[model samples]
Target chain A: MATEAGDNATLKRKAHQGRPVSLMRKTVIHALLLGVCLVFMAPFAWMISTSLKPKDQLMAPSPTLVPQQCEAQIDGAWVAVDREADDLDITCLLVRPVGTSYSQVILPDMLHEGYELLQTVDATPDRPWAKVRERLPGGEFGELRVVPVSELRYRAVPQWSNYKEVVRHDQMKFPLFMRNTLVIAALGVIGSLFGSSLAAYAFAKIKFRGRGVLFVVMLSTMMIPFPVLMVPMFSMFKWMGENQLGTWLGTFKPLWVPMWFGSAFNIFLLRQFFKTIPNELSEAARIDGCSELGIFLRIVLPLSRPALAVVALFTFMWVWNDFLGPLIYLQNQEQYTLVLGLQAYQSQHTGAEWHYLMATSVLIVLPIVVLFFIAQRTFIEGIATTGMKG
Target chain B: MALKDHNTLKGLAFLSPWLIGFVAFMALPIGLSFYYSLSVYPLYDEPAYVGADNYAQLLWEPDGSGGYGDALFWKSLKNTGYFALLSLPAMMIVSLGLALLLNTRVAGLSIYRTIIFLPSIIPIMAAAMVFLLFADSQDGVLNAMLAKIGIDGPDWLGSEAMAMPSLALLSVWGVGHTVVIYLAGLQDVPASLYEAAEIDGAGAWSKLWHVTLPCISPVIFFNLIIAIIGTVQYFLQPYVITNGGPSESTYVLTMYLYDKAFQYHEFGYASAMAWIMFVIILVLTGLAFWTSKRWVHYQGE
Candidate 1:
């Protein structure tokens, strides 16, 4: 729709337009858009800011926008502490303090002891200290200087190495978790996709008897809460001599075997996407001397790339992020996925040193976020358009 | 004759994978679970043919504790049902409203969509952590913000009265998927219908009621089915946020089953509970589909 200018612009050109209606509309729309944008962006802004603030600020009665500078005795001499500066710099005043925990004290505590905080050199959570070389007594405090920079050059410190430390924190190492996650997700994607695609193709393309009823029965399984199945499924697996995999495959079949059967949601999505393909293509393939297998591999498989991608992406995500599945199925920590590893990380730390836990969470989520960015359009379309033909 | 035989063989070959998977993985396991539900098969112990004891215990036993005990099973089902009931309607309406608001001819609509979808991308564990901070009863961001408005906020995740509702509200925060679905539905509502409604002197409310709602009923139906199924299986929010605490108010069926099977190792009774839940979901979904003939309007129909 074009901006209607006949009523408002005609009056404007007449030089007697008291109020510009279109302009008012534009202003109102702009303000509304800006307000919504703010609401959307607030959580992210809060996360970043809260991460930077000291732990005390996180639970403060009245929250402070920025941390306050405090003074304390650094060495024998007094030194100043200033947090607002971009580059943290410390000026020395007195000699070194007797206590080794001098770094633990905030700059404001040092300054209150009569030491002026010249500047804050660094206030990173990784390195909380602001290094200052204070002057001896009777020396001018003016010559001593501290500078602060806003940017925390964490990369310069190469805290990425701490990622390794995070991994090795307990039995829940990143490499082991990554290996398990990749293995399980790979098997799950292959199994579920293979099974679901076949089942979906039958439901969508085949003109078999009882196809509709079977499809409805299959889709109806979607309503069964997984927990409802979890208990029974475990008992069945145990009874099926799954533990006997120790003698056969030398590993439990619980990891990947279940997906060889179709999952209700994936089958529904694949079936819907499959049905959108015209039957004429399959019929034409049959006329061209192609068998059903040939038609599936040559015509249908190649035609269903987008749907396959959606299926694979979703399977990868669900299986990767699945905590309950791994928590139940996998017995050994060696078999744990990344979600299990995160659980272990939290349990190991028991809420102590939240920074490490948060840091590890950031590491874990980064790859998933990257994957989402890469295939976001398809992901959104895959989910939203499932209703188009239903 | 050989070529004709080969063609039939190929058809069977194409269909073999699904047939094999269905029989081996799904049908066998499901059948076995049914049998096990009739017997007592405790993990790390020999199975015993205790004919209908597990089911009976689930139904009539006032003595048994945990999964077989009727109180816990019924309580969990009630809690889970309560969660689904409160969250689904609120989430659907809020999502539709958001979709309608974003559907207006506004610039940066993609930005709004991205903002709304942001929560879905957040790892559930991370979101739980954030909510822990935000919903802290004493000095939380939620309570502090409310203090500014001169209204004292009650304990959200802390009190039994508010825990499940708090979890339900948390579910709505990730209603991004629903909003996207509604957007697709709104797009399909043919601009012509709105124009015709306007031409017939229908105001915005009347136009929405007559033109918009009817047009999107099928999409709403689709979302409703998916939402109900998803909510019934809800575990992560309650598991992480409340830990099924505040006197087990947020203890859902899934959580109960999980604790039984994994934590307590009561395999036989847990299996029975699971089977009952499966039957409940199956009947409910069947009923929904059966009733859709009346309300769920197809475009051609």
Candidate 2:
């Protein structure tokens, strides 16, 4: 085309320029689109990267992101990083007695105290400073050059027992937290979705007196900040526990009972989706002697699968991640949800073993991440279909 | 005509599950919440009929402990409002931009859509943790990259000045839902209209402005409404990332209300907060709906 245009006069070249102009537009759009997509994806990329970095690298200056090669001292032999080790470093800050003159001490000499902080330099075969230099800050060329192995005050050791310690803590238990979270998430989702679906069906399909008023009223409930109701709901539940419903409903009633009725938000969403279905379909069913209930069950329910799946998935995610609700409703440690458990872990380990806490957090977030990965397509469809009104 | 009563009853019966749930969960809780807002319901004793004391305290009382003079409640409301104002518009623009991208005949368009939508499905708990990895102070990937460009990243989620904006930026990543809606709206736009504009010597920009904008105005309105409502109720990201931290710069209404109810066990006060929030959402939504008619072009209309 360029050769042909070159063979022609100036008029032909001018006409040929139009082709490139459209090409430029296409190129610009594609570039702009790629940039926007990357912006949308940056967070997940950051998350996965952070999850893989080693603890020392986590807080290091120019942290070695590609896990560094390190020698692990095992049975008096040097093992590589990620290699099995029988010995582990359990670094502890030994506090001198309050009245004593020494402010604080890092005890390398306390060999009989059961924990031995493994020195990386001592374990490496030759040029141990090279290994130490790689692990420590300032690298090969800075003020802090590696001293002889004996002079190093601190030893970096792995704490394999920390995970067990966290799980078995007396004030908090991990398994029970998992069980409670599962129960609450499962029940909350089922109850909220089922209850909301019923209410939504009414709002969407039924023609009754005050239907408009009822919908407005239902929507009005959305405006009431949940915190406003939190106090009343809590008191009511505690009161119920102490008196009337206590004899039968048990303490968990406050947490799960409201799900049977419906959430205004879910009802609103379901109703909107339901309205999209043809009214004539229901009318036809009625003409064929099908009851309204039959139409809802046999027709509306089946056709509304996409919306229902969305509602279920959303409800499940919310209930699973809910922190404040379970904290307020269930006082028993045995009844604590996964979020509460994380909070409890935060409280207990305010200063130490944060790596284990991070690990536990990974455990907590893993299932939801997996679920999201599985149902992500359906979830998007649901959100997009639900009407842009949050 | 005689069978109409029976038909209505049948319709009502189909709606019964929702009706019963509405009264039990939505209506009853809301009413009780209103009543509780008007009284004092300390956990250890009977709720005293304080009769507007909670409302008065929320609005007028200067005492730091209980009344309208309370700094925490006002602060949280202010913070929440600020978040909503900033995040809503940003979300709309970004989501629309995404819709424009996905609107093309890209190779593996569905794959791109799924990848873009992935974050929206991530439970806030997980995503928030992941966000912290990138937004963390000193050593996070974001700051590390910024250093290479000779620009220093602020302590993002940790800095009081930048915290809310950081949270807002985090929200832009999960706009796949809005994008999907915009894509649907964009697809609905008739191709002939663009063709007509082109024949009239309109450039691509003018064609998009005159034809595409008017066609998808309603979708924009829908996205706007949802964004506003969702922002007003914003809790999860701020709550998880900063823990409303760096000195409560990101403290939000829901979290403060949560503190009042569960942490302090101030039932009446929390209820009042919730009620105030409800009013705010109602007013905002009403405003959106009112303004929508002017800018939003309904296809049928």
CA lDDT of every candidate = 0.66, 0.65
**Candidate 2 C-alpha lDDT tens digits along A287-371:** 9999766888899889877777777788777777776576667766777777777766655654233445555566676677687
lDDT of candidate 1 over A1-390, digit per residue (tens): 011111110001011111233566656756765675565555444444444443323454665434322233544433433222222334323222344323322444354543333344444554334333232333223222332233212111112333555667665577888888898889989988887887777766665545657667675555556665566566656655565534212133566776776676777677666666778888998999987767777887788888788888888888777877777777777877777777766666544444355555666666777887888787777766565444
- iRMSD, per candidate, in listed order: 8.7, 9.3
lDDT of 2: 0.65
Interface RMSD of 2: 9.3
Q: Which candidate should be chosen as best, given DockQ against the real structure? A: 2
